[model samples]
Target: MLWAGSKGGLEVRTSAGGATVLRGRFPYAVPTVLKDGRERLREVFEARAFAASVAAGGDIHLLVHHDFDRPLASRGAGSLEISDGDDALTFEATIAPEMRGVSYVADFLGTLSAGLVGGISPGFRVAEGGALVKRDSEGLLRVVRSAELIEISAVTKPAYPQAQIEARNWTPCTAAEDRTLVHALNRWRL
Candidate 1:
Protein backbone atom coordinates (compact mmCIF):
# COMPACT_ATOMS: atom_id res chain seq x y z
CA MET A 1 0.00 0.00 0.00
CA LEU A 2 1.41 3.39 -1.06
CA TRP A 3 0.02 6.77 0.03
CA ALA A 4 -3.18 5.44 1.52
CA GLY A 5 -2.73 7.78 4.48
CA SER A 6 0.95 8.71 4.56
CA LYS A 7 3.30 6.11 3.07
CA GLY A 8 4.05 7.72 -0.33
CA GLY A 9 5.92 5.09 -2.32
CA LEU A 10 5.49 1.79 -4.14
CA GLU A 11 5.30 -1.83 -2.97
CA VAL A 12 6.47 -4.67 -5.22
CA ARG A 13 5.96 -8.38 -4.56
CA THR A 14 7.11 -11.58 -6.29
CA SER A 15 5.58 -15.05 -6.31
CA ALA A 16 5.55 -18.35 -8.27
CA GLY A 17 4.92 -18.79 -12.03
CA GLY A 18 7.00 -15.71 -12.82
CA ALA A 19 4.39 -13.64 -11.04
CA THR A 20 4.96 -9.91 -10.52
CA VAL A 21 2.83 -7.29 -8.84
CA LEU A 22 3.29 -3.53 -9.13
CA ARG A 23 1.63 -1.42 -6.46
CA GLY A 24 1.87 2.32 -5.92
CA ARG A 25 0.35 5.78 -6.39
CA PHE A 26 -1.58 6.26 -9.64
CA PRO A 27 -2.58 9.65 -11.02
CA TYR A 28 -6.06 8.31 -11.64
CA ALA A 29 -7.03 11.92 -11.12
CA VAL A 30 -5.35 14.65 -13.10
CA PRO A 31 -5.89 18.41 -13.07
CA THR A 32 -6.84 20.08 -16.32
CA VAL A 33 -7.87 23.60 -17.34
CA LEU A 34 -11.05 24.22 -19.28
CA LYS A 35 -11.45 26.74 -22.11
CA ASP A 36 -12.73 29.33 -19.60
CA GLY A 37 -9.50 28.82 -17.61
CA ARG A 38 -11.23 26.79 -14.92
CA GLU A 39 -9.25 23.86 -13.63
CA ARG A 40 -10.60 20.30 -13.80
CA LEU A 41 -9.21 17.03 -12.49
CA ARG A 42 -9.28 14.26 -15.07
CA GLU A 43 -9.80 10.73 -13.87
CA VAL A 44 -8.33 7.97 -16.05
CA PHE A 45 -9.15 4.36 -15.12
CA GLU A 46 -11.49 4.64 -12.18
CA ALA A 47 -12.89 1.60 -10.41
CA ARG A 48 -15.82 0.76 -12.66
CA ALA A 49 -14.00 1.08 -15.97
CA PHE A 50 -11.07 -0.97 -14.69
CA ALA A 51 -13.37 -3.78 -13.64
CA ALA A 52 -15.12 -3.92 -17.00
CA SER A 53 -11.88 -4.06 -18.97
CA VAL A 54 -10.63 -6.97 -16.91
CA ALA A 55 -13.90 -8.77 -17.58
CA ALA A 56 -13.57 -8.06 -21.29
CA GLY A 57 -10.05 -9.49 -21.28
CA GLY A 58 -8.22 -6.52 -22.69
CA ASP A 59 -4.77 -7.18 -24.09
CA ILE A 60 -2.09 -6.42 -21.52
CA HIS A 61 1.64 -6.91 -21.32
CA LEU A 62 4.63 -6.43 -19.07
CA LEU A 63 7.18 -4.22 -20.73
CA VAL A 64 10.03 -1.84 -20.12
CA HIS A 65 9.01 1.83 -20.10
CA HIS A 66 5.43 1.04 -21.03
CA ASP A 67 6.50 0.63 -24.62
CA PHE A 68 3.92 -1.24 -26.68
CA ASP A 69 6.23 -1.73 -29.63
CA ARG A 70 8.04 -4.42 -27.65
CA PRO A 71 7.24 -6.43 -24.53
CA LEU A 72 9.55 -8.26 -22.16
CA ALA A 73 6.89 -10.57 -20.76
CA SER A 74 4.17 -12.39 -22.70
CA ARG A 75 0.48 -11.98 -22.01
CA GLY A 76 -0.91 -13.95 -19.10
CA ALA A 77 -2.13 -17.50 -19.68
CA GLY A 78 -5.11 -16.56 -17.52
CA SER A 79 -6.98 -13.46 -16.49
CA LEU A 80 -5.01 -10.46 -15.22
CA GLU A 81 -6.15 -8.50 -12.19
CA ILE A 82 -5.63 -4.88 -11.19
CA SER A 83 -7.03 -4.40 -7.74
CA ASP A 84 -7.80 -0.94 -6.42
CA GLY A 85 -6.19 -1.36 -3.05
CA ASP A 86 -5.73 1.59 -0.71
CA ASP A 87 -4.22 4.53 -2.66
CA ALA A 88 -2.79 2.24 -5.32
CA LEU A 89 -3.98 -0.15 -8.04
CA THR A 90 -2.29 -3.52 -7.71
CA PHE A 91 -1.39 -4.82 -11.20
CA GLU A 92 -0.82 -8.54 -10.88
CA ALA A 93 0.02 -11.05 -13.65
CA THR A 94 2.41 -13.78 -14.65
CA ILE A 95 5.35 -12.93 -16.88
CA ALA A 96 5.51 -15.45 -19.70
CA PRO A 97 8.49 -16.33 -21.80
CA GLU A 98 9.05 -14.49 -25.11
CA MET A 99 8.14 -17.70 -26.98
CA ARG A 100 9.37 -21.15 -26.21
CA GLY A 101 11.09 -23.38 -28.77
CA VAL A 102 14.14 -25.54 -28.13
CA SER A 103 16.25 -23.47 -25.67
CA TYR A 104 13.91 -20.50 -25.91
CA VAL A 105 12.73 -21.00 -22.34
CA ALA A 106 16.35 -21.12 -21.24
CA ASP A 107 17.05 -17.79 -22.94
CA PHE A 108 13.95 -16.31 -21.39
CA LEU A 109 15.13 -17.42 -17.98
CA GLY A 110 18.42 -15.65 -18.57
CA THR A 111 16.60 -12.41 -19.34
CA LEU A 112 14.56 -12.64 -16.15
CA SER A 113 17.68 -13.37 -14.13
CA ALA A 114 19.08 -10.07 -15.41
CA GLY A 115 16.09 -8.30 -13.75
CA LEU A 116 14.06 -5.25 -14.79
CA VAL A 117 14.88 -1.58 -14.35
CA GLY A 118 12.80 1.45 -13.22
CA GLY A 119 9.22 2.04 -11.96
CA ILE A 120 5.84 0.66 -13.03
CA SER A 121 2.98 2.02 -15.22
CA PRO A 122 -0.18 0.87 -17.03
CA GLY A 123 -1.33 1.74 -20.55
CA PHE A 124 -5.09 2.01 -20.92
CA ARG A 125 -7.92 3.81 -22.70
CA VAL A 126 -10.99 5.63 -21.40
CA ALA A 127 -14.52 4.89 -22.51
CA GLU A 128 -16.92 7.85 -22.02
CA GLY A 129 -14.34 9.78 -20.03
CA GLY A 130 -16.98 11.63 -18.08
CA ALA A 131 -16.46 13.94 -15.12
CA LEU A 132 -17.29 13.73 -11.44
CA VAL A 133 -16.80 15.84 -8.33
CA LYS A 134 -15.07 14.74 -5.16
CA ARG A 135 -13.82 16.52 -2.04
CA ASP A 136 -10.75 15.48 -0.11
CA SER A 137 -8.30 16.91 2.43
CA GLU A 138 -5.89 17.53 -0.42
CA GLY A 139 -8.50 19.57 -2.31
CA LEU A 140 -11.61 19.42 -4.45
CA LEU A 141 -11.19 17.74 -7.84
CA ARG A 142 -13.32 17.51 -10.96
CA VAL A 143 -12.36 14.03 -12.09
CA VAL A 144 -12.80 13.69 -15.85
CA ARG A 145 -13.40 9.99 -16.52
CA SER A 146 -12.11 6.50 -16.00
CA ALA A 147 -10.22 4.25 -18.44
CA GLU A 148 -9.87 0.59 -19.44
CA LEU A 149 -6.50 -0.93 -18.61
CA ILE A 150 -4.46 -2.30 -21.51
CA GLU A 151 -1.08 -3.29 -20.16
CA ILE A 152 0.79 -2.71 -16.91
CA SER A 153 4.49 -2.31 -17.53
CA ALA A 154 7.74 -1.43 -15.84
CA VAL A 155 8.16 2.24 -16.60
CA THR A 156 10.48 5.08 -15.70
CA LYS A 157 7.86 7.35 -14.04
CA PRO A 158 4.13 6.90 -13.83
CA ALA A 159 1.35 9.46 -13.32
CA TYR A 160 1.58 9.71 -9.54
CA PRO A 161 4.63 10.11 -7.30
CA GLN A 162 6.00 6.53 -6.95
CA ALA A 163 5.99 2.97 -8.36
CA GLN A 164 7.79 -0.37 -7.92
CA ILE A 165 8.01 -3.79 -9.65
CA GLU A 166 8.50 -7.36 -8.37
CA ALA A 167 9.25 -10.36 -10.60
CA ARG A 168 9.61 -13.97 -9.41
CA ASN A 169 10.66 -17.25 -11.12
CA TRP A 170 14.38 -17.29 -11.49
CA THR A 171 16.43 -20.17 -12.92
CA PRO A 172 19.91 -20.30 -14.32
CA CYS A 173 20.30 -20.86 -18.08
CA THR A 174 22.97 -23.54 -17.94
CA ALA A 175 21.79 -25.65 -20.88
CA ALA A 176 24.53 -26.94 -23.17
CA GLU A 177 22.56 -25.22 -25.93
CA ASP A 178 23.42 -21.82 -24.38
CA ARG A 179 26.88 -22.15 -25.88
CA THR A 180 25.34 -22.03 -29.35
CA LEU A 181 23.48 -18.72 -28.70
CA VAL A 182 26.26 -16.69 -30.30
CA HIS A 183 25.86 -18.62 -33.55
CA ALA A 184 22.13 -17.95 -33.47
CA LEU A 185 22.67 -14.26 -32.84
CA ASN A 186 25.13 -14.08 -35.69
CA ARG A 187 22.57 -15.72 -37.95
CA TRP A 188 19.89 -13.26 -36.80
CA ARG A 189 22.18 -10.33 -37.61
CA LEU A 190 22.41 -11.59 -41.15
Candidate 2:
Protein backbone atom coordinates (compact mmCIF):
# COMPACT_ATOMS: atom_id res chain seq x y z
CA MET A 1 0.00 0.00 0.00
CA LEU A 2 1.21 3.47 -0.84
CA TRP A 3 0.46 6.37 1.48
CA ALA A 4 1.14 10.05 0.82
CA GLY A 5 2.10 12.28 3.74
CA SER A 6 2.76 16.00 3.77
CA LYS A 7 6.00 15.72 5.70
CA GLY A 8 8.69 17.86 4.02
CA GLY A 9 7.20 18.32 0.59
CA LEU A 10 5.20 15.21 -0.30
CA GLU A 11 6.50 11.88 0.95
CA VAL A 12 5.04 8.53 -0.02
CA ARG A 13 5.49 5.12 1.56
CA THR A 14 4.91 1.77 -0.12
CA SER A 15 4.99 -1.74 1.34
CA ALA A 16 7.69 -3.28 -0.87
CA GLY A 17 7.99 -0.66 -3.58
CA GLY A 18 10.17 1.51 -1.32
CA ALA A 19 9.33 4.97 -0.02
CA THR A 20 9.56 8.17 -2.06
CA VAL A 21 10.45 11.36 -0.31
CA LEU A 22 10.17 14.63 -2.26
CA ARG A 23 11.77 17.42 -0.31
CA GLY A 24 14.45 20.06 -0.21
CA ARG A 25 14.83 23.07 -2.50
CA PHE A 26 14.39 22.48 -6.19
CA PRO A 27 13.48 24.43 -9.26
CA TYR A 28 9.82 23.49 -8.80
CA ALA A 29 7.38 21.36 -6.83
CA VAL A 30 6.02 17.95 -7.71
CA PRO A 31 2.42 19.04 -8.28
CA THR A 32 3.53 22.23 -9.91
CA VAL A 33 1.31 24.82 -11.59
CA LEU A 34 2.31 23.42 -15.01
CA LYS A 35 0.45 20.17 -14.42
CA ASP A 36 -2.65 22.12 -13.42
CA GLY A 37 -2.37 24.18 -16.59
CA ARG A 38 -2.13 21.04 -18.72
CA GLU A 39 -5.23 19.70 -17.04
CA ARG A 40 -7.08 22.91 -17.80
CA LEU A 41 -6.14 22.64 -21.45
CA ARG A 42 -7.53 19.12 -21.63
CA GLU A 43 -10.70 20.25 -19.90
CA VAL A 44 -11.25 23.19 -22.25
CA PHE A 45 -10.89 21.04 -25.32
CA GLU A 46 -13.17 18.38 -23.88
CA ALA A 47 -15.92 20.89 -23.20
CA ARG A 48 -19.11 20.33 -25.20
CA ALA A 49 -19.19 23.92 -26.40
CA PHE A 50 -16.01 23.33 -28.41
CA ALA A 51 -17.18 20.08 -30.00
CA ALA A 52 -17.73 21.34 -33.51
CA SER A 53 -14.49 23.27 -33.72
CA VAL A 54 -12.47 20.44 -32.21
CA ALA A 55 -13.90 17.94 -34.67
CA ALA A 56 -12.82 20.14 -37.55
CA GLY A 57 -9.22 20.11 -36.21
CA GLY A 58 -9.48 23.73 -35.17
CA ASP A 59 -7.40 25.06 -32.31
CA ILE A 60 -9.19 25.37 -29.00
CA HIS A 61 -9.00 28.81 -27.42
CA LEU A 62 -6.81 28.73 -24.32
CA LEU A 63 -8.24 30.90 -21.61
CA VAL A 64 -5.63 29.89 -19.06
CA HIS A 65 -2.23 31.52 -18.73
CA HIS A 66 1.05 29.87 -19.65
CA ASP A 67 2.94 27.54 -17.27
CA PHE A 68 5.45 29.96 -15.84
CA ASP A 69 7.04 27.39 -13.58
CA ARG A 70 8.22 25.30 -16.50
CA PRO A 71 11.93 25.55 -17.34
CA LEU A 72 11.05 25.88 -21.01
CA ALA A 73 8.75 28.80 -20.33
CA SER A 74 10.87 31.03 -22.50
CA ARG A 75 10.70 28.56 -25.37
CA GLY A 76 6.93 28.90 -25.12
CA ALA A 77 6.70 25.50 -26.77
CA GLY A 78 7.68 21.87 -26.41
CA SER A 79 9.64 19.62 -28.72
CA LEU A 80 7.73 17.93 -31.57
CA GLU A 81 8.71 15.87 -34.58
CA ILE A 82 6.63 14.09 -37.19
CA SER A 83 6.77 12.66 -40.66
CA ASP A 84 4.50 11.00 -43.27
CA GLY A 85 1.30 9.35 -42.13
CA ASP A 86 -2.33 9.45 -43.12
CA ASP A 87 -2.49 12.51 -40.86
CA ALA A 88 0.28 12.16 -38.36
CA LEU A 89 0.83 14.46 -35.39
CA THR A 90 3.81 13.91 -33.14
CA PHE A 91 4.49 15.74 -29.90
CA GLU A 92 7.64 15.63 -27.78
CA ALA A 93 8.51 17.52 -24.64
CA THR A 94 11.90 17.86 -23.00
CA ILE A 95 12.07 17.31 -19.24
CA ALA A 96 14.97 18.85 -17.39
CA PRO A 97 16.80 17.00 -14.60
CA GLU A 98 14.67 18.78 -12.02
CA MET A 99 11.54 17.63 -13.78
CA ARG A 100 12.65 14.00 -14.07
CA GLY A 101 12.16 13.35 -10.36
CA VAL A 102 8.93 15.31 -10.30
CA SER A 103 6.65 12.51 -11.44
CA TYR A 104 6.69 8.96 -12.72
CA VAL A 105 5.24 10.01 -16.07
CA ALA A 106 6.24 6.67 -17.56
CA ASP A 107 4.43 4.74 -14.83
CA PHE A 108 1.36 6.88 -15.36
CA LEU A 109 1.75 6.20 -19.07
CA GLY A 110 2.02 2.45 -18.52
CA THR A 111 -1.30 2.43 -16.68
CA LEU A 112 -2.81 4.20 -19.65
CA SER A 113 -1.38 1.58 -22.01
CA ALA A 114 -2.88 -1.27 -20.00
CA GLY A 115 -6.27 0.40 -20.22
CA LEU A 116 -5.97 0.99 -23.97
CA VAL A 117 -4.77 -2.53 -24.74
CA GLY A 118 -7.50 -3.85 -22.49
CA GLY A 119 -10.14 -1.87 -24.37
CA ILE A 120 -8.70 -2.21 -27.88
CA SER A 121 -7.33 -5.68 -27.11
CA PRO A 122 -5.40 -7.21 -30.02
CA GLY A 123 -5.37 -3.94 -31.94
CA PHE A 124 -2.17 -2.87 -30.19
CA ARG A 125 1.19 -4.49 -30.96
CA VAL A 126 3.94 -4.22 -28.40
CA ALA A 127 7.20 -4.57 -30.30
CA GLU A 128 10.28 -6.36 -28.96
CA GLY A 129 12.21 -3.17 -28.31
CA GLY A 130 9.23 -1.57 -26.55
CA ALA A 131 7.88 0.34 -29.52
CA LEU A 132 4.12 0.16 -29.96
CA VAL A 133 2.56 -0.45 -33.36
CA LYS A 134 0.25 2.42 -34.27
CA ARG A 135 -1.56 3.35 -37.44
CA ASP A 136 -2.90 6.70 -38.49
CA SER A 137 -6.50 7.25 -39.59
CA GLU A 138 -5.37 6.45 -43.13
CA GLY A 139 -3.64 3.27 -41.98
CA LEU A 140 -0.04 4.42 -42.27
CA LEU A 141 2.39 2.61 -39.97
CA ARG A 142 4.25 4.36 -37.14
CA VAL A 143 5.65 3.40 -33.78
CA VAL A 144 5.48 5.30 -30.51
CA ARG A 145 5.31 4.79 -26.78
CA SER A 146 2.21 2.79 -25.89
CA ALA A 147 0.70 5.55 -23.80
CA GLU A 148 1.27 8.18 -26.46
CA LEU A 149 -0.22 5.81 -28.99
CA ILE A 150 -3.28 5.36 -26.81
CA GLU A 151 -3.69 9.11 -26.30
CA ILE A 152 -3.51 9.71 -30.03
CA SER A 153 -6.60 7.64 -30.68
CA ALA A 154 -8.45 7.69 -27.37
CA VAL A 155 -8.16 11.41 -26.81
CA THR A 156 -9.47 12.27 -30.28
CA LYS A 157 -12.22 9.72 -30.81
CA PRO A 158 -15.71 10.98 -29.98
CA ALA A 159 -16.44 7.60 -28.46
CA TYR A 160 -14.55 4.38 -27.93
CA PRO A 161 -14.68 2.15 -30.99
CA GLN A 162 -14.64 -1.58 -30.43
CA ALA A 163 -13.19 -2.40 -33.85
CA GLN A 164 -9.99 -4.41 -33.93
CA ILE A 165 -6.93 -3.51 -36.00
CA GLU A 166 -5.77 -5.75 -38.87
CA ALA A 167 -2.05 -5.47 -38.23
CA ARG A 168 -0.05 -8.48 -37.01
CA ASN A 169 0.74 -8.42 -33.32
CA TRP A 170 4.34 -8.09 -32.19
CA THR A 171 6.04 -9.84 -29.30
CA PRO A 172 5.32 -8.68 -25.75
CA CYS A 173 7.67 -6.11 -24.26
CA THR A 174 9.78 -7.10 -21.25
CA ALA A 175 11.06 -5.34 -18.13
CA ALA A 176 13.66 -3.67 -20.34
CA GLU A 177 10.81 -1.72 -21.84
CA ASP A 178 10.86 0.55 -18.81
CA ARG A 179 14.51 1.36 -19.38
CA THR A 180 13.84 2.12 -23.02
CA LEU A 181 10.99 4.42 -22.07
CA VAL A 182 13.21 6.32 -19.65
CA HIS A 183 15.90 6.69 -22.28
CA ALA A 184 13.42 7.98 -24.84
CA LEU A 185 11.96 10.40 -22.34
CA ASN A 186 15.39 11.80 -21.48
CA ARG A 187 16.89 11.70 -24.98
CA TRP A 188 17.47 15.43 -24.88
CA ARG A 189 19.32 15.10 -21.62
CA LEU A 190 21.68 12.60 -23.15
User: Highest TM-score: which candidate?
Assistant: 1
Prediction 2 global C-alpha lDDT = 0.22
Worst 10 residues of 1 by lDDT: 164-173
lDDT for 161 in candidate 2 is 27
What are the RMSDs of all candidates, in order? 14.9, 20.8
For model 1, residues 16-112, the per-residue Cα lDDT tens digits are 6554443444433333221122333222224343555555654555545444454545445453455653244555544443333425334433444
What would the per-residue lDDT of candidate 2 be over residues 1-190, giving only the tens digit for each residue?
A: 0001111111122224332211111111112111122222000000121122223442211100111121211113322111212222212223233433544433433333454212211112233443333433433232322211211111111111222121222334455653342322221100
Candidate 2: segments with Cα more than 4 A from true spot = 1-75, 81-86, 104-158, 161-190
- TM-score, predicted candidate 1 vs. hidden true structure: 0.46
Clashes of each: 3, 0
Please tell me which predicted candidate would have the highest lDDT against the true structure: 1
Computed on alpha carbons, the lDDT of every model, listed in order, comes to 0.40, 0.22
Candidate 2 to truth, TM = 0.20
